[model samples]
Target: MTVDVDFHHGDTIDAVFPEADVRVQVGFAAPYAAAVNYGSDPHWPPLTPMVRWTNKLGWENYDLQEADSEDALWQKVDNRRAAGDPLPGAYHLAAHIAENGTKPMLYASDAFIEASQRGEKWLEGRGYDAETPVVEIARDFANWSLELANDNLVSRVSAASDGNLQRSAFPAKVIAK
Candidate 1:
């Protein structure tokens, strides 16, 4: 939700060029950005932000479909908290979020998951019973996503060499003049 604050796309830079040393860069000017992305070790964030976030989720999401009744989310938060439900179906999620921070819901997108699965597919194609493992389901899986992407890129280049590099669609004729 916070990646592209104010619709400026100011947080991350995505670019790809062979001549360039790097193709992708993701960072934030705001100091709190990193904390939100990777999460912090169980610390209390300000309650006001938590309250605002709770209220925001309680309202109409427009086109977004929510499983529970939208208007009752905030109303049930206090009760859910009292009952010790950490998430409470997204109702008291803000309270847990304030105290424990959060996993990177956006930092590591589906691309990372696909890349991770690619390895499993490659092994399966070789007749090995391979599994992608449980990294994606782990608590710190977000951090591992980046590592997986890096590993996939390096291995692809090493395995195929320049054969994987982009080639021109048109071919040059070898006919004698």
Candidate 2:
């Protein structure tokens, strides 16, 4: 199994988590804005560039629940695909992060999972594999845990345990895949 450490803006995760597993993946989430001026208008939309940074860093997956709309989410994914970038999902992320080119990790919110299970269809509508696993965390970082395991095909990790560590080890067979 592969491990991923999530860091929020202004939070230095590296300082808190042990670095014993250098092979463990690291990713950042949250919004950040940059000031820019558009052509002749002298005004620019505030753009948070975390998605682009994730693409550049080859992060396995990104959670877009903060996006205001499905269209906005598609724009980011489409832009990345058009640019020939890597945009992985839960299953893919874990595979990628594994030493054997397995998927890495999934980053999401509780709402996302609930929505998917309810057949919201937005994720599938946006070209994501509906079967992908997700790591759902709380918006406030209060409680965290993993859910949705079927025959050990997919696993989720949430911030349920102290220090946001995964309480259960990922199944060994899943990693071998």
Candidate 3:
């Protein structure tokens, strides 16, 4: 099982679980401010400790790379945070699943769940939480038939005709709650 940690302007939970092919989890970190300029920008922040640990255990490519300009990237981050957009990465992942009708095993921690709940509440307050057919279409990828493992670690395994879990490993105890 490969583990990856992505950071952006949104709420997300953290937890561990085992599914069809691997064990995974998601979590959050302190709000990070993208450096305003490159030369002086802090070294691109390191991947979350969880991700690092996971990589050490052989999980790779957990962090997706975005090759946008610093200014552009920060602008997007600001806009999403201000607009309370779902984590763009998550959105992209969801879209990938939808388009391909493949489900990927996902694990998140309680913190990540809380963050998602907060984001949902914010959307609800803005009247943007209504279910829409487009959303159904976008979320359809979730139905592609991949196994889902949650906090319990019970290892709920399932099969996805179209998707497969990327295999990687994590160090023992990558993050603390």
Q: How does each model score on lDDT? A: 0.36, 0.31, 0.30
TM-scores, each model vs. reference: 0.25, 0.19, 0.17
**lDDT agreement of model 2 with the native:** 0.31
Give residue 31's lDDT in candidate 3 (0 to 100). Answer: 27
| Global CA lDDT computed for model 1 | 0.36
Query: Using alpha carbons, what is the TM-score of model 2?
Result: 0.19
Q: Rank the candidates by TM-score, best first.
A: 1, 2, 3
Candidate 2 positional error at 175, Å: 46
Question: What is the overall TM-score of model 1 with all chains considered together?
Answer: 0.25
Judged by TM-score relative to the true structure, which candidate is superior, 2 or 3? 2
Which is the winner by lDDT between candidate 2 and candidate 3? Answer: 2
RMSD of each: 18.6, 21.3, 21.4
Give the alpha carbon lDDT tens digit for every residue of 34-68 in model 3.
11101122133333322322333343322222444
- Candidate 3: what lDDT? 0.30
